[model samples]
Target: MQNYIFEIQLKVRDYECDIQGIVNNAVYQNYLEHARHEYLHSKNISFKQLTADGIVLMVSRIEMDFKRSLTSGDTFAVKLRIERQGAKLIFFEDIFNVSDGALYLKAKVDVIAKINDKLSRGEIFDTLNL
Candidate 1:
């Protein structure tokens, strides 16, 4: 099984930062969310489509490491990678960094695909294979 990765370039916004001129901790989660959506889009999958097919993707856990501070007007890159864990869940990793490749935050997420409130029992990743 091969894992998939997606990279996105992002610019820090003024509103995303705090009085200290650094990004708020909660914003790191937002960056991870954007990368995750981009990854799904690259696979030709949409959350709406998945819902229509009775599939719900839910985050089970998240672990984040903040290595550096990001300021407003700073540009950075977000990289997302996903690996199959079993028939029901997938593990995801996301990294946020400066345009110069300086690391800002690293996050790991576990997500599961569900149908009818139960995890899909088939080849989960294959369902969205592009």
Candidate 2:
């Protein structure tokens, strides 16, 4: 079974939908990114501080599978879990409808940290003991 370490709830905005009245594909990425930022904030990890310290964390790759469509006003939850994979940290994220528990999307985001402009194993994981 998948264990989610964090979750955030959000609603679909009218402007996020396309002519078909379903959320645009690209907007799902925004939801995932926002949830990640919020998760980091909850852990007291500040992106601004990381930048100032010359440590930059970036998404190296993203793989997403769309399972269902979300329309305007639909409420959903973004759930996340992180694991260290060799030199990278992989974030496993899932989006599900809050009303009916229907999964909408699943994504794996591969991230790597660069220290002083050089790619290196992220030390943040050690700091957070994640």
Candidate 3:
């Protein structure tokens, strides 16, 4: 079975859909980002607090594949796993239809942490050991 460190359930909203009756591609990015934030919160990490401490985590790159379309009212789950590679933290995220388990999208996000104004490995990630 595929392992996921965290998962969040969400429903497609009417406003998120395009004229084609499917979720707009950009909306999927929001869903993925929300899931990542929630996952960090679950681990007792606060994005706001990090920023306040001068530790900023920014997405350096994102690669996504759209497998299926999600329509308004469709419930789905956003799942993710994290790994550390060199100085970058990679988040592997996937979205699936909650009812049928159909994959809607898969994405890989590379994140880098900056301290003060320099790009360095934030100490916070060391605590997570991801």
**Best candidate according to lDDT:** 2
Model 2 pairs whose backbones collide: none
Error of 1 at 84 (Å): 1.3
Better of 2 and 3 by lDDT: 2
**What's the lDDT for candidate 3?**
0.91
In terms of lDDT, the poorest run of 10 residues in model 3 is: 121-130
C-alpha lDDT of candidate 2 relative to the true structure: 0.93
**For candidate 3, lDDT tens digit of each residue in 1-130?**
6688899999999999999999999999999999999998998888999899988999999999999999999999999988888888989999999999999999999999988979986455786655
lDDT for 7 (candidate 2):
97
TM-score of each: 0.86, 0.96, 0.95
Please give the ranking of all candidate structures by TM-score, highest first, separated by commas. 2, 3, 1
Cα lDDT tens digits for candidate 1, 6-97? 77888999999999999999998888888888778877789888888888888878889888999999988887666666653444554556
Arrange candidates, best lDDT first: 2, 3, 1
> Candidate 3 has what TM-score?
0.95
Per-residue accuracy of model 2 over 7-92 as CA lDDT, tens digit each? 99999999999999999999999999999999999988888898999888899999999999999999999999999987789999
C-alpha lDDT score of every prediction, in listed order: 0.76, 0.93, 0.91
